[model samples]
Target: MARKWAGTAIVIYFLILVFMYWYLFNGDTSLPEKWVGTAADPATFLNARELMLSEQYSQIRNFMFFAYNAFDWIVYFFILLFGLSRVFERVAASQSKWRIVQAAVYLFLLSLLSYVVTFPLSYISYNLSKSYHISTQTFSSWMKDGLIDFWVNFGQMVIIVSVLYWLINKSPKKWWFHAWILSIPFFFFMMFIQPVVIDPLYNDFYPLKNKELETEILKLASQADIPAEHVYEVNMAEKTNALNAYVTGIGANSRIVLWDTTLNRLKEKEILVIMAHEMGHYVEKHIYIGIAGYLILTFAGLWLTARLMNSIITRYGKVLKITGIGNLSSLPLFLLVTAMLLFASSPLSNFVSRYQEARADQYAMEMLQDKDSAITMFQELTRSGLSQVNPPLLVKWFRYSHPTMLERIISVENYHTVEK
Candidate 1:
């Protein structure tokens, strides 16, 4: 029996590695060349490209995160699921039919109590933003928003738990296989639905009825030849002074939205540059790329866990008091594995994200074709959000997505570097 299980596990493990290696390293990009050039000065883009090459590990810039922590997300999810399940199962192993129900009830209650504990901390954070004049909302408004965010997050958690429960009761042997199949579409559904159905639940949005601003933005959209209508201005001023402009949703519901603060604070040129940068993301199809990358990462993690979790539970369940491989209580042991991997990779994950951001910035430059506008808008965003402009290299390695202020400046300045 053990030999049979071992063989199955090995096959799954080997196949997973093959699939993952192909997905990550195949690197066939048929998409547009991310144009990365201004209309008038083509040579400038080429020159900047060479400078980018020197700072990068390959054609792809691999700062520490890509090398170090690219797999952290996968690691985290697996650990939390496997580890917590085992712990709770062992702790709640009562013969009563009510044991599982009691455990679930307790878990839900703890979550509520945990909210009570954290609510004060959230309030303090909210008040601090207000004190800094960064937030305009009242405490009552903050609480209301917090509650809404909580409900949304809760809904997601419920979905995950429901699926897990179904797996345990319905088709224990096929759980992992079916879970992966379900996740593929679930991942895309989140990408597709979040902007339209989920985001609007929190904020009030009205069409950009301001003709002057709408016309200016639409003209830019027209240049990009994308069909976007009705700029939506969000009532974000009620929340925070954080300025944002992004294109969200799909098809007819799709549009660019500028937070009120973003519109009010940025000059015409800065706003144009900011909008251009966002348009660049859309035109380059970076959103699809980002989502695809994340899915690949997730699927790889699931494959690893499916290959290992059952083997571990079968061997270790006796010591942990778990009755069977499918025991709900054994999940914590599985979760622990995933968590440990995530913890190990935390120091390097930021690099992958920063690379993505850098590509987006490059795309923005190509679309706007204006260095000055990009600089001002970015600087303003950094300042308005109280974002650290440049931290120690180590600090950024672990934290930031965008490069340091100086790195961004240098990258932009290369465009003016007399063509290398």
Candidate 2:
């Protein structure tokens, strides 16, 4: 039965891939009139060739998104069906009597297996970005970064998985609720530490080198009522050509960070506009709101996962070679359920994110009262990132966390900020 289901899954996966290829390749690539700035300067407007390149790049990326997701589902299913998870559990148990030690070993091995399985698709993505001249990192640098990513992710997963199972072992019926309770604080802790700790591991961060520009940004932040003393800049030119600026961390750790690419590529006014948008996130308290929303969703998701996991184990326990929910070997089953639920929830989560982002955009325009700079900055961002302003509905629904560049620019054009 498992083999039969696996065969059907493969066929469906390929069929879906075929449909995506056709859909992406055949989609309209014409730029909407609204996307064009009022000035209509060539410097701010992408030409036909550039537009085509952008369209193709975005479409390929969209295709890859579907492919990667479906591939992950398939991989998870196979791991469960083949009882490979149980094999890992047995090996780890043999190494240690302590359940925590066993869990750590099992998780490490599982993470390693997952990384090996997923590396090919990840490398393909990197190669595609390089071929498009988007990524500036050399092969060695990319590999180094990949290693960093793997270990960091694995370390986090180990902690999470260990806590989760311990909770389950203690109270299977109430574990999800317990986990959700613990996760609330964990979320805030990560938010606080990420800017100070995790982010600097990948790139060098320092105070903005351009004192004049930093002063201008600080003034904007002050006007927005953000208590920012200095702006931070990361040396991103070594890895990618993408332009970005954002606020990160919480409380004292909170700071505005700009990519070196942004400073090198954009005008002072444009950078200020970007800074205003970031400050909007803080002023609006979107970070706290986002966390609250996430906790709510997680509460519901964990509840559902627990219910479904129990139901599945009740029926397919013997077939999948799993003993019960608290069994060490059931980690794959738990992961599979959570992964699917998360994927299913993407459209909702992304919709909320897009709305928050749009609000921030509005705040930026209102605060700066600079529509022209806003429009031009967005255009430059689109050009730099090869973003599709009017993406297909599916991609927009599931993947986009912000309004389309077209929508953002159009909104700026029509916006009339109140007189201060």
Candidate 3:
């Protein structure tokens, strides 16, 4: 049995490599379509969203898109990969159903422990800013959010496990087909509703409270040709010190959010650039592109796994708390393989993203010509957040986003240099 499993594992590993090669080559990693200032309307944003979500299945999958959420996906995917590694890290093998269930249970507890490990660091992150300390959120507040995050994620895994177990036991012959059929519609639904339905559970959002700032931002949007009638301000400063601004989901949830810290620190020139960069996302129709990207990537992975590794993973899956390829108990393994593939291709993925981010920054710079302010504010960000001023080239390409401070400075300098 051991030899049999080993043979299966070896074959599966080779197929994974071959199929991943196919994916890297086949994926349209072409530079995202450029949208000089005139990509799409900030108003017509609704149309783009509606068209994507028009089909019920597409809406479900859209909720799962996570395209605009590249960073979160990066974070979660890595953590989950680490968690999955624990399965293989263990030397003991258990094949019984109860024993396998216990393994899954232990995995869940281990994940919780990882959350606890990060708890204090998360709290300190909220308090790092000395002034106004705008946030006095206690450790308890941080803990509460942590618990919510933990349970929400675990619950998702739980549901998946239950359904997968049922499918494997009852429909083993058609498990993959059934699972894929269910996943396709479910995937689209997630894309449609996650931001609108799920995000509010975490943050409180009110329409832009200060009318002057609202008008100022609105005028900036109009100048950028973003047709947003209302701007929103979130109490992000209440939660943590890290600043963020992003164009949310496609339509209803597409409002841009300003961390109050961001609002307080940067000048209008810098802020507008941030907003314009976000609008670059909107006008470029990244949301649509993202939904399509995920579905294609997921289906491709699934297709290859079914064709090559399904029997191997399923046959010995119990040894690692995995029941079968189509079982939710085996999701960690699937996730592990997917992450490995992504990790190996991290450079390419980051390269694609850096290109998009650069384009967005250019859109903002062309609109504002605020290179000076952009540099100054970024310098402040580096100082306050302890971002390394210069990082090794490989690290910047592989791990960092927003580029190194030096990268930004040089890019701006060169733009000025070339224009002169």
TM-score of candidate 1 relative to the true fold: 0.68
Between 2 and 3, whose lDDT is larger? 2
Error of 3 at 192 (Å): 4.0
> Which is the better candidate, 2 or 3, if ranked by TM-score?
2
- Going through the candidates in order, what is the number of backbone clashes in each? 23, 0, 17
Query: Please, what is the TM-score per model?
Result: 0.68, 0.96, 0.63
Off by over 4 Å in 3: 1-137, 158-188, 304-331, 416-420
Candidate 3 lDDT tens digits, 278-361: 877666766666667666656665565555446655554445544445434354455555565555556665776666677777
What C-alpha lDDT do the candidate models reach, one value each? 0.60, 0.87, 0.55
lDDT of 1 by residue, 162-250 (tens): 57656756777677667777887777677678777888888888887677878888888888887876788888987887798888766
Model 2 agreement with the true structure over 1-420: per-residue lDDT tens digits: 888877988999999899988877887654556544553322358888877788878998899999999898888778888888899999999999987788889988888898899999999999999988889999999999889988888888788888999999899799999999999888889989999999998999999999999999989888888888989999999999999888888889987899999999999999988888888888888888888889889999999999999999899887788998987788888888888899889999999998889899998888889988987898899889988877887888889989887678878878997787
